[model samples]
Target: MYERQNQRHVPGHTFSTPELAWAWLRSEQTLIDRGEWTPPATRRQEQEAQAQREAETSTPFGAYARDWIANRTTPRGTPLAPRTVSEYHSYLEGPLADFAGRQLADVSRADVKAWWQRFADKPRYRHHAYAFAKSVYKAAVKDGLLDANPWDIDNAARVVLQTPKTVRATMINDLTPEDVQRVADATQPEQWQALVLLLAWTGLRPGEAFGLQRRDIKTSYIDGIPCWRIHVARAVSRSRTPDGIRVDTIGTPKTPESIRHVWLPPHLVPAMEDHLDRFSQPRAEGLIFPSTNEALPFATTQQVAGTTGKQRRDRTGGKVRPPSGFNGARESIGMPGLRLYDLRHWARRILLSAGMGELAVEQYMGHRLPAVQGAYAVLDPRQVWPVMLRCSDLAGWTPSAAAPAGRDTAVLLNEMTAEQLAAAVSAMSPDQLAVLVPTLSPEALVRLLGTQGRP
Candidate 1:
């Protein structure tokens, strides 16, 4: 009970949101309306009986592993992703076979830890081995086969190969405004121009950028100025077949937090418009970067000859190698070793330079953190568009507010976000907020109003 509380793990009764809580209550209400639902009298007895039955017929780890994985389900109640299932099978067969023939109930924390120590040198699969052990033992507890999980040992998670120095070079030396224009000028086939802008300008992951569709782009008002709101809900993934063809899977983003909206600068709209006018399909549902022949919208294939080409060395010695549009663009800009990911790294710096907060940056980057942080602040385009546009403001590319306000500074200030306004108001305290008559975010301003009534 203490362990469960420490992990913040709760049984399926109440959920995080009012909507989910209501749904749960409604479900019980429906069951009660059916006349067959009632509170159980012998809950402990029933649990004890089930446990006794499980103990009577001891199951081996190999067989139990199969059953455990087969029953595993995702958050939305869908079956686990194919890639996830495949990895689980691989771990069971390779690093976790020591307990295969042993009784599932008899497996100890010591055995799981010893197996983890043996595989910790690989670095990549170090955490995976520990995770699999925790999962199997956790499943056993849930299935009434064990009172507690044997694989919750903390020492099992420490990987010997991990080091702070192994990280990539610091992203401090970021791309500049002039550097961006040069790269944009060099992109060929014309369509790649917007692709270049989307990557460098927006902090979207490569897969997220590649998976963008025409319909995902929408326009909305931010601080009374119209801006583009790019809906980022999905990403592209690839898998290689036995016959050697690479297939693309259009799935949900890497995590739930990754499903977010990004605000592109108003000046950048024309570039998107120009790219869509020429490259994107006529229909709204078409991919922005479809294959040349237009058969596969989110994918293209590479031949075996190209895969084993003597002209170059492989990035990962694997399949599904797509031609890079940025590699050629790099030489045109006179900058080499500037990777596609560098653009995203530089974007964070640009936002920070523009006075955007770390929380705002993390939200825009779609970084996964604890669930509580998301509840207080759900950043809409109105809150994040202006922050992102500040970098473009550096280029003197004023398209929206260029005419509305005489000075560019006034235009940008007028475009200050609801969150920014809220934060500013909150920092000013009661005396300052009293003098400021501007209409602010009601959620934040209500507290100020209440404080104004106080001494």
Candidate 2:
């Protein structure tokens, strides 16, 4: 029965099923407020409630990933860089998309493991998947959506997904002089040859030589010896090129250690000076090697010259011009694979092998000492001359080669003993010596030990 509350003219209602009336009175406010008793639609209500829960639980993984992507779009996206973001997007759209849907909570470890197994065949993709998953999981964990990151489950650090083979420093060290020569020779262009020489001889990166300016070369006295001062400030390489621009650009050196002023070898000094005189524009900031039409001198000018000022006829017109100087000379000589930068590496090795002090070597290379302030204190260049001389002596150039002359051979050989020589030979492993020592003449060995010896 139902009766209206506060009714002057009262109206009453009676239910057919008493159980329904009791159920409605207990659960449904609509009937209870009217003083009526009617049961709720329990079966329909229960089914609808269950459906709502399933909808919440069954949220697609892709949807969550989209949410994550939108959240990171502003903050992380800026720093990710366009190229890096493009790569991440590629992984997401291709590989990761495979597991994007299905509630994250419902994702099993076996499912994750299976995905990894497929990626194992594609090492780069596997690496990208792992990295992307870890990043996403970290964000999820931070948001309190996930209690634990699934990416943290395995030893991701130990995993080595196959990718392109890395070029090793050890391999560079292993390269013999002949190997250097071969690489240099194969490069037909003069610029490549010069670049190789600079890298091998001075250990100057390909870009560093490109960044060199006319004024960077100063005719200065080093160790009381006339030399050229190579002030390293900039680097020019393809890395700095704009997306659409084929012209290479210049930028600051790769590291603080890279910005240095090195004293040129006396023999090389004349050639370097000659090179400057011949090729360098006298303008203060004139690139040591400037492009013919490149407008932005901040980057891209080096041994390679290209006409990219919309003036060149070549379809691919914006390439660095071939190298010049000794590289050109080498090309003329029918030598294969000679590089300009190789001279720098060769020089470093010579100085090191000649027993130059660490500080002196650091100074020679324009490298900073951690203990001292890196700015403005002039030191005597003469103090470094003796070691420099020793380096020149060790290089031992013929009339045809460019190297400084020094103290007589007999004087150098008067310094080592047989025992010391033998001990040195024994203590240094054959492999180590084979790897590091370029050549060991008997006289040089004696000189190195500071005793007269037959070795």
Candidate 3:
């Protein structure tokens, strides 16, 4: 019997022999001496706790992981994005499938190592799976289901899969203003021209651009200058459903930093106005870039089949054919591998080259800055307008010249002698010179200034 706090409890187990009872009594006395004595009821409670822990540890890892993902929430207390949930499901079904039958406690470091080896040819997927597994194991440890996390491989989650040198070079290749114009001109249906230009100039993600509504575009006067701004509040995300059907979900932008007002360059304002007038719906709530079915927003992978007049008249269904997409436009312009995302890089490069501060460029591109700077740095439209004007000039963009007919302005500027350039530049007004100054090299500017001082 054990007694504590005026309560007495008897042991539930029966002793088989005198020696066994005496040994148990000795152990209990030893526990008392060490100040570790507990009443019989308290011991029973501890035994129940041990049993519960055992049951939790014995839970199958796959089931635990699925449950963890299902209950996962963002830092803002919102459910995980649908695309994120789908990606986690893919990790479970693909690389982590081998652990389905194994108990949580049975997953050893050796098992993880062996599983990781299978993805030798797919380092990107391997890193993602390793991260997911680490997160799940971390949760298991927190839940008291595991004593320690088994994903102890050093730097396993830090693996940086490098792009091929050739591919990397191609990806970073400078897209000249003429090249962008060419691709936009080559883009079929004519309606997509503004989209191509917007992506290239504004550095908007395709999803964010597609999620735009007429109301998102608003005109603001900055120091008496009319500035058109794209208010990016939402984005369209594509994810595969349980049945493997791809669907688009319109939601908040990728991050809080992505929700911003991107200033439209003066040169592109006309194109935007044209797009709104011709392609976009008249309603404020209607999508700026809707699919052929105007009721639905534009899908990232949507391709409408083109039908000939004869096929339409036949009444027998026209053979489905792929429409000429961005791929066709790129191929037509002799850039077979140029991705639409690459246009964002072009915009960043142009802004940086025109002497925009890194923080300012990051703001323009809707990219998050370093932690301390991100919290404090604010982009003023007054400051952005001057830099944008310079960037527009550097990009060879003219408000009146939407399409280039003669030699490129950049080419013309390059061919002219310092004296000739000075003569030509002197004819321009103060605003034109302000726009032209950032585009000229220091050496060229010095020479032009020297020539201006001469006859």
Name the candidate that leads on TM-score: 3
Reference-based lDDT, each prediction: 0.62, 0.52, 0.74
Model 3 pairs whose backbones collide: none
lDDT string for model 1 (1-455, tens) is 01221343222344678787667556556855896543432444577798886764388877787677788888758787655666676676667777777887777777766765676567568588668768877777776668878787675566554323223234225457777877776665566667667766778887787678889998765444467888998887665443445467788887778898887866677788888888787687788776554565463323100122123445688555433455656655656555667778877777666546777788888886556886776555444554655556655565342233223322333445444543333323243334333534455355444545333
- Candidate 3 has a TM-score of 0.73
Question: Per-residue lDDT of 1-455 in model 3, one digit per residue for the tens?
Answer: 65656887566788889898888778878987999887866899989999999999899988998899899998769888999988888887788888876899998998888877878889888898889989999999998888899987877867663756567456556567778878887776777778888888888988898899999988864333346888999999887787666678999998888999887876777788888899887789988877765455564634321222122343475654432666667767767667777788888876666545678789878887888998898876545554555556655654432232122233344444564455445434465556556776667677777776574
The estimated TM-scores of all candidates read 0.58, 0.47, 0.73
The per-prediction tally of clashing pairs is: 0, 58, 0
After superposition on all C-alphas, the RMSD of every candidate to the true structure, in Å, is 16.9, 13.3, 8.4
lDDT per residue as tens, model 2, 1-455: 33334432111345678786676555545655676533333445667777865665466666776556555653323433333445555566678887676686676667777887777777656776678777876776686565677665476546562221233333334555565555555444433444444455456665677677777777754223565567888776453122333345466665556777665544445445554676555788776554544565532324342222223343586655543444444444444243344455555665666555455566566565665544534434443343444433333421221222223312322332333233333333344345324445656565555544533
Q: Is candidate 1 or candidate 3 better by TM-score?
A: 3
Candidate 1 segments whose C-alpha is farther than 4 A from its true place = 1-62, 73-83, 93-121, 141-169, 172-193, 219-226, 238-247, 254-257, 291-297, 300-345, 367-373, 378-380, 383-385, 395-455
* Residue 46 lDDT (model 3): 89
Candidate 2 wrongly placed segments (more than 4 Å): 1-145, 152-186, 222-225, 236-249, 270-282, 289-351, 356-394, 398-455
- Worst ten in a row by lDDT for model 1: 301-310
Sort by TM-score, top down from the best: 3, 1, 2
